[model samples]
Target: MLQEAVDNFVTSIANGEMERSGGSRNTIMAYRNDLGQLCSHIQTLGITSWPRVTHEHIGNYVRHLRDEHAYRPTTLARKLAAYKSFFRYLSQKGVVTTDPALGVCLPPVERELPQIMTTEQVQTLFQLPERDTPMGVRDLAMLHLLYATGMRVSELIALDVEHFRAQDAAMQCVGVRGNVRYLPLTSAAMDVLDRYLQHGRPHFLRDASETALFVNHHGERLTRQGFWLIIKGYARRAGIEALTPHKLRHAFAMHMINSGMDLGSVQELLGHAHISTTQFYCQLASAQHR
Candidate 1:
């Protein structure tokens, strides 16, 4: 019965307005967990129908999450978004006339300044010995492209061979929500990418591989988890503390913004459909100005 509701919700999402959002399978699964928890909690309180849910019931569920389950503010906020989305789904389907989660509030979260590597630190990190080994060459290209383009890890991994134009010094990539945008590559990034494609990638290929820009030792397209593990290894080798792939993106955005590129251009380059989404980086820049 609960599975049916989840399936219906997901189907509606697919057939309805959210179809254009290009949400991933992982995001849909998260919404399922969140809505399932709310439904279970409501059922435990003897409330079964969606129409029976009220704002107070929503508050109770949030309290239960915070006090009983000890969810963090960010987790709580995500759960709230999930619930809101679920109710919105219900409203669109005429299951409920009112959206009970509409007025529900999320806990305030502090927006902290994003960490970025200095230009010198980036130079030093990229200067590590290149053994002409496959992994070494791939790592060099990966780090260079990350900082150069400010692409998210998922976007980077999704890159295809045809998306890049070597002679034109440009690449087109899809961002979060599947919006495609073009970026002009720096000379340094182009050099590393050229080397990786010509020499390094051929060494990694097995039988009948596809046109993915980066591949693992097995000659398969790299997974997000695989990329993270590789990045962790490289960060340790470079003697950089707590370095993750996103820090490179932060460094890229920070450097671009600080170099006086307007926020609109940054937003477009990052393929953020909403200006509000891109504004967070501006907040990070402002914190540094303080």
Candidate 2:
């Protein structure tokens, strides 16, 4: 009887959710799974009717998920959402006097720390690209600059050839909304940039007037998505499970903070609008040392 009610409720919402979100079969399946577990929990207690299930029963079930099952806060929150939706349906159909799941709050979503690669892992990724070939030279330079400056992928893709002031060994980075910052590059990164400009960039630039620093095979400006694909390919080759442009940026910030670089300077280099944003990396660096 509890299973029948669960099925009906899931079927009722599945169509509407699918129509609205498109391809929401997975979400509907999650709701079904949540209610099935609820039914199993109450059945073990000898409760048979939908109306016999009380608010206390719901609380016990949630506690069981948290304590016995050891579900993460995120998974618990998602289950709570499913519970609320299910009880809301039952309340509307007069099966329950009140919505048991309504007043129950979702678990707080924890903030995930940034993913940082080890110095050895960073070296492994950087060394994957063949420095001699044009594509390899371009990718290697971009990877080095990302780790060197902690710049956003958007800023990396938006780079222009003139932005690389090789004479100063610093990049003239132009951010969104006309904001500009001079990102000091390592002498090594600058050397690669010089090589890319001389041997690599010229080979990629089909249009003589093209000003973009990085170009695709079609000779158009390289996109953020393109850079992401490049990173993923190198990561796979280097045997890293997960890699993204932001991960590289996070790694750069972590390394800088670990090296005793002041948060203010790191903030300036990364072009962060707030000092608070830069402070998170300090915690990461401290935890790593401990």
Candidate 3:
């Protein structure tokens, strides 16, 4: 029965249900890893099915992850979140009558300020992508768009040509709950996008019907992994450490605040559902000024 539950979970992932539910591949993999360990632990306790698992079983599993495996608080919290989500999924499908992982206590996670690149570092990264070649031009546009819009990499890759309103100098992105937010494009980013469309994108266009704003050599929409590789390659060339999309996003917010953009404006531009989420960048901006 343990195997059956695991199989069902695997099937859900394979069927693209997770992606349809707005889960990224990386996130789904992390959930899979966390739940796999929990299933293994449950099997040792003579529990085979999710229906037979009780809240006590889940509580012991958390303690085991904390005490026996010496998992850090953040790791423990993430694992418990995966367990709760999995049990909730099972309950919804009638595989379990009750969500055994409900109301489980999770370890506290200490918040850390997200990492960001200095202006000098960003300049170096922007200069690393060669301007004379198609791939380089594409990479440059991607990097500039990321920094300019503060778009999450997921949203960045999901973009299509129709999303951009060139006449308005704006791009509309689908945010939470299918609501759309239009972000004004900076002159520099707009110029780069124009160059990419006119010169660079055509080079990669294998399919004339492809609607993706960014495409690989095969003319398919760029995947998140593909974007990560491109960013990491440039980061290494720029001699920057620990650079990521989230770091660039933080950099965008902090840079905007330093440049006198108000917090509320930045929140709206970033499509943040909560103003408090945008306020964290204010904290970073204050720290930097100090």
Candidate 4:
């Protein structure tokens, strides 16, 4: 029965149901990991079926994760979400008459400030060599755009030529769960975008792909991995140690907070569904001011 449950979950994910429900590959993998951990815990108690899961079993699993595994509160919350999703799937499919994990509650997660680059460091990062070479030009634009808009790496990669309104100094991003948000471009960002569009992109275009805004020399859309490499390269060139793409996002958020934007506005700009997620930037900005 446990095997059947796993099979059903996998099949449902593959059948586009998960995507329709706004689940990404990362979300699906996380759920798989969480459910796998639960099953492993259940096996320790000799329970082998979805129907055999009891409230006591769910409680024990949570305790085991907290007490034995010492998982962080956020990790525990993610695991709980996985369990809830799995059980919901089972109930929807009529494989389970009742959901044992329905009443389970995740522990509260502590809010932590993400690492951000200093304004000076941001300035230095953009001081990279301005060469007319394709790679150099693309790297400059990528870094500029990231810092300017605070766009997630995935959102940047998913961008298409049509998403930009270059004449209006804005670009629209379809963020998580397909929510569209408009990002007003900074002068620097607009300049870089203009240069890339005029000089860099035309060199990369091919008949096979035309819609993607950022492309490699091979004319394929710039992948997340490729973007990472570009970021790392620029970091090294700028002599900035331990910098990552996310640091740019952190800096952007904190800068906005420091500039007196409220949490709700920042949340909307970042495409966060919940204002609580954006509140972390406020904390970081306050700490920096202190």
Please give the range of 10 consecutive residues that has the lowest summed lDDT in model 2: 15-24
Off by over 4 Å in 1: 2-4, 14-22, 43-54, 67-74, 88-102, 107-111, 119-130, 172-182, 207-209, 232-244, 262-268, 272-282
Query: Which candidate's TM-score is highest?
Result: 3
Distance from true location, Cα of 209 in model 1, Å: 6.7
TM-score of each: 0.75, 0.66, 0.82, 0.78
* Tens digits of lDDT, candidate 3, 216-283: 98889999889999888887888888888788888888888888998889998888889998888888
Cα lDDT of candidate 3 equals 0.84
lDDT of 1: 0.83
Candidates in order have lDDT scores of: 0.83, 0.84, 0.84, 0.83
Alpha-carbon error at 209 in model 2, in Å?
Answer: 1.7
Q: How many Å off is the CA of 89 in candidate 3?
A: 6.2
What residue pairs clash in candidate 3, if any at all? Answer: none
lDDT of 2 by residue, 184-207 (tens): 899879988989989998887789
- The residue pairs in collision within model 4 are none
Error of 2 at 256 (Å): 1.3
- Could you tell me the C-alpha RMSD of candidate 2 in Å? 7.6
Local lDDT at 204 for model 2: 79
Model 2 regions more than 4 Å off: 1-105
Comparing 1 and 3 by lDDT, which wins? 3
What is candidate 4's lDDT per residue for 60-89, written digit by digit as tens? 789888999899888888888777778888
